[model samples]
Target: MASAVRDRTAGTTILDALETYLAAPKPRDPGDPSREEFLDLVHATPALRDHFMRMQRNWETTLAHAIAEESGLPDDDLQARALARFALDIGALAQESPDPAHALRTLFARLRNGWTDFPHPGP
Candidate 1:
């Protein structure tokens, strides 16, 4: 993946490729090359896989921090639990929604509303 990112011949980074892939219309059937091609790219590139894993970790941490701050929860354990619950809800939403984009938007809206409704912990 590092080489793919640095490939001067391609004139594009792995991030650029990812953006292009995501921006394109999603495949409707099993024969679609987009999904397979993207997976192949990821599997072939170790750096891309590592980068994605790191991004996932960072995303979870960021979400946990945001939830903790908004809810005024000082305990690390509480933040971790909240993050786990949030992730589960997101997974469920993604599985239930036909459109991935809509699912993501709904997840954000749900999280924001939930946090807003939560009673902040006293200092």
Candidate 2:
């Protein structure tokens, strides 16, 4: 049914795809894809790349703030807990995602709408 397909493919948000893309390991077998193939995988997915860039920028900004708050190293280290927060955010976004591809597009749309005063690059 429509609902089932939506449920199966719908939970792939920008952040989810970004993390998956980032954490993907290099192919090990000879039959596996080459480095260029892997790069193409990410490049071909423009929506995913946009999401990754946005998330990376946000994290960098957030981590910078955290660092500024701390006299020493920030508490927001790249630990499981931090990643879990990101995953949860992604899941929430995914729940509203119409499909895997639409997820990032929708996110960008929302972000752009709220930033009328500030200019942002087109996704």
What are the lDDT figures for the candidates, one per model?
Answer: 0.53, 0.48
Given candidate 2, what's the lDDT at residue 59?
Answer: 58
The C-alpha TM-scores of every prediction are 0.39, 0.27
Per-residue alpha-carbon lDDT of model 1 for 12-117, expressed as tens digits?
A: 5333432333334654876666644765787789999888667766655655554454446663656545654556456545645678667665565565456566
Locate the minimum summed-lDDT window of 10 residues in model 2: 1-10
Clashes of each: 1, 0
lDDT of 2 by residue, 21-122 (tens): 433343579988764576578678998778867876675555343433332435455543344344435534654555644664554454435555666788
lDDT at residue 98 of model 1 (Cα atoms): 74
Residue ranges of candidate 1 with Cα displaced over 4 Å: 1-40, 78-123
Best TM-score among the predictions, by candidate number: 1
**What CA RMSD would you report for each candidate?**
13.1, 17.3
